[model samples]
Target chain A: NAGVTQTPKFQVLKTGQSMTLQCAQDMNHEYMSWYRQDPGMGLRLIHYSVGAGITDQGEVPNGYNVSRLNKREFSLRLESAAPSQTSVYFCASSAGGTGVSYEQYFGPGTRLTVT
Target chain B: LAKTTQPISMDSYEGQEVNITCSHNNIATNDYITWYQQFPSQGPRFIIQGYKTKVTNEVASLFIPADRKSSTLSLPRVSLSDTAVYYCLVGPDYGGATNKLIFGTGTLLAVQP
Candidate 1:
């Protein structure tokens, strides 16, 4: 059902360039999250949204911004991309906003490389 | 959030059962242990979750000890496609406060051909 979809599966940007990574879920989940995976670092959260119009900062929100305009979309934007921003970005959604044991469903991922 | 610790890697032959354990000594009373599997370049997918005892799904089984301090994910009759990184997560998950999963170096499972 294309549970979660991310746009621009791969991208390359020069330093100071700006770009947006889009995420959407057809599962109608209440919570959505953004994370970046770097070599040996595992995955770190970038930002999240509890519901439409409700957004919050995650462990690694620097150099990035997020918006939750509607129930189906949560997008991540890099204002001015840096070399450190190069990594594989993922988006996730969960029905767990209401329960204690909610499990997250993830998007395929967006691999971004900044030179 | 309770911090989690797991192995760096594991290896097993096809048709064998593989058990990967994770330790979360600081786990709170309300925290739950969850597991996810990830192939390279893909997002981690949820495998199973449990508060205590054992919970089994079609893909894997999760066993949480009585003390709630650790948990194990057991894959039965694993095949080549089962080779991936496994992550164990422990958190309160109250009001989405624990939404960000802080991943350690996940166990890289390599199933022999």
Candidate 2:
């Protein structure tokens, strides 16, 4: 199972450009999440979805938007990229259910550079 | 949300045991402790998790004390392949506005040959 997959492994954008990082999971998970990791820092949550059509902001949600159209996909969009937005973005999913563990499987990550 | 604190880095030699500790003083009653390992250019993978006491898996062991304010991840017989960033996460077990995990600066374990 491609536990989790991300598209456009690498990308470069201008200061005002916009892009979307795609995330998908085949684990039939009900919870999907987006996170960003800056150099020398830990991953911070950007947005998350409880299930299809449900999304919510996370710790560092500025300049970012997320959509969870179905249980298998979640996308993170940068409306207007900034230098501060350049970082490694990761998407994760978890089998959310009562009596289930909180183990999250992550994608390979998308490296974004904003000039 | 529960916050975690861990060392920035640690050094170990081949065949040695490496223990990385994390502190989560504000962890709630429903919070569980989980650890993840990440290599370069890859995403973090789950190592092990524990609610209390000791939990051991094929890869690692997690030890949580009675107070539950801290937990330790023990990697036995480390090798170069095990050299990676170890993250300690603390969060609740269910879904809620604050159910998301809180990852702090992980411990960069460098295994020497």
Candidate 3:
């Protein structure tokens, strides 16, 4: 099903530069999320969307913004990159329902380095 | 969100059984314990999950005691490929329309030949 896929597997940016990481899922999931993983740390949520056109902030939302324009696409944008943002970014999607718990499918992840 | 505590690293030999335990003393009644496995340079993958007692899947088994304050992930006959970071997560069992998962530092399991 191709599950979930992320774009720009690797990126390097100068401080204050802006970029966007793209995520797409073919599973027809209602929920999508963005997370960042630093060295020797667990993945932390950056932002999430309940559905198309409904976005919300997550645990680590600062310096990051997200938009879910359609059901299959969720994009994360960094307005101004900082050194702290240098980490691996992952995208996940889940089929949310009334009685179902969250079972997420993650993408390969994008490695970003902000100098 | 309930916080999870696990060992930073564990080492075992191939063909041996490895059991990694996690503690979530503050886990709420509605929260479920889930485990994820992640290889280097890859995203985390769901392994097993349970609320209480025992749950077994093809990949691994999740054992939760009566109190549910702690849980263990048992890997049978481990192999080098099974060496990875294991994350224990606690989240609402039925969050309904707004379910989100939080992850903590996972235990790194190294399987040697």
Candidate 4:
């Protein structure tokens, strides 16, 4: 299984430009999440999905949007890129149960640079 | 979601055991403490997790006290490869609207020879 895979390992966007970050998991997890990590800092959740066709805002969801059209795919979209949005983005999936089943599997991460 | 506090950085020598502790004063009854290790330019990986007592895995061990207010992650026989940022997260284990995981600044571990 691929666990979780993200597209475009690295991307550079200009001010006001928009882009979508794609995340897919073959582990058939019911929960998926998008997080951003700044230099020397831990990850902050941007958005998450409990299941297909369900998405919700997270701690830092102001500048982002998300969609989960299917159980295997979760996408994070930036409507207007800003320099502050420049950071490494990661996608994770979990089995969506209690206890140890909540262990999340992360993707390789995408490095975004907004100029 | 409970907030977690941990050391900013720690230094250790190779072959020595390293323990990183996290404090979560407002941990809820259903919340579980989990640890993740992040390397440079990579994604964070799960190390260990536990609610009470101890949880041992091949990579690390997680120890939680009776109160579940604080937890420790023990890494045995560390190497230079073990150098990374460790994050302690407290969240509910069940899936629902509150199934989000919050990450703090994390503790950076630097292993020396």
Best by lDDT: 3
Cα error, residue A74 of model 4, in Å, equals 1.3
**lDDT by residue (tens digit), candidate 1, B28-103:** 9888888889998789888888889999999999998889888999999999999999989887757664545777
lDDT string for model 4 (B1-113, tens) is 68889999999999999999999999999887889899998898888888899999899989899999899999999999999999998887676555667778899999999
Q: Give per-residue lDDT, candidate 3, residue A59.
A: 84
Kindly report which residue stretches of model 3 are placed more than 4 angstroms away from their true locations once superposed.
A97-100, B96-99
Model 1 lDDT tens row, A1-115: 8899999999999999999999999998999999899987788888888899999888888899999999999999999999999999999898765223677888999999999
The collision pairs in model 2 are none
Error of 2 at B38 (Å): 1.4
Kindly report which residue stretches of model 4 are placed more than 4 angstroms away from their true locations once superposed.
A97-101
Task: State what share of the real interface contacts each candidate retains.
Answer: 0.49, 0.41, 0.49, 0.48
Model 2 docking category: acceptable
Measured against the true structure, the TM-scores of the candidates, in listed sequence, are 0.95, 0.93, 0.96, 0.93
Question: Candidate 1 DockQ category?
Answer: medium
The stretch of ten residues in a row with the least summed lDDT in candidate 2 chain B is B95-104
- The CA-based lDDT of model 4 is what? 0.89
Query: Candidates 1 and 3: which is better by TM-score?
Result: 3
Q: What does candidate 3's lDDT look like per residue over A9-78, in tens digits?
A: 9999999999999999999998888999999999888888889999888889999999999999999999
Worst 10 residues of 1 chain B by lDDT: B93-102
Q: What is the DockQ for all candidates, taken in turn?
A: 0.55, 0.48, 0.53, 0.51
**Candidates 1 and 4: which is better by TM-score?**
1
Q: Is the docking of candidate 3 incorrect, acceptable, medium or high quality?
A: medium
What is the C-alpha lDDT profile of model 3 across B1-113, one tens digit per residue?
A: 68889999999999999999999999889988889999999998989888999999999999999998999999999999999999998878674446567778899999999
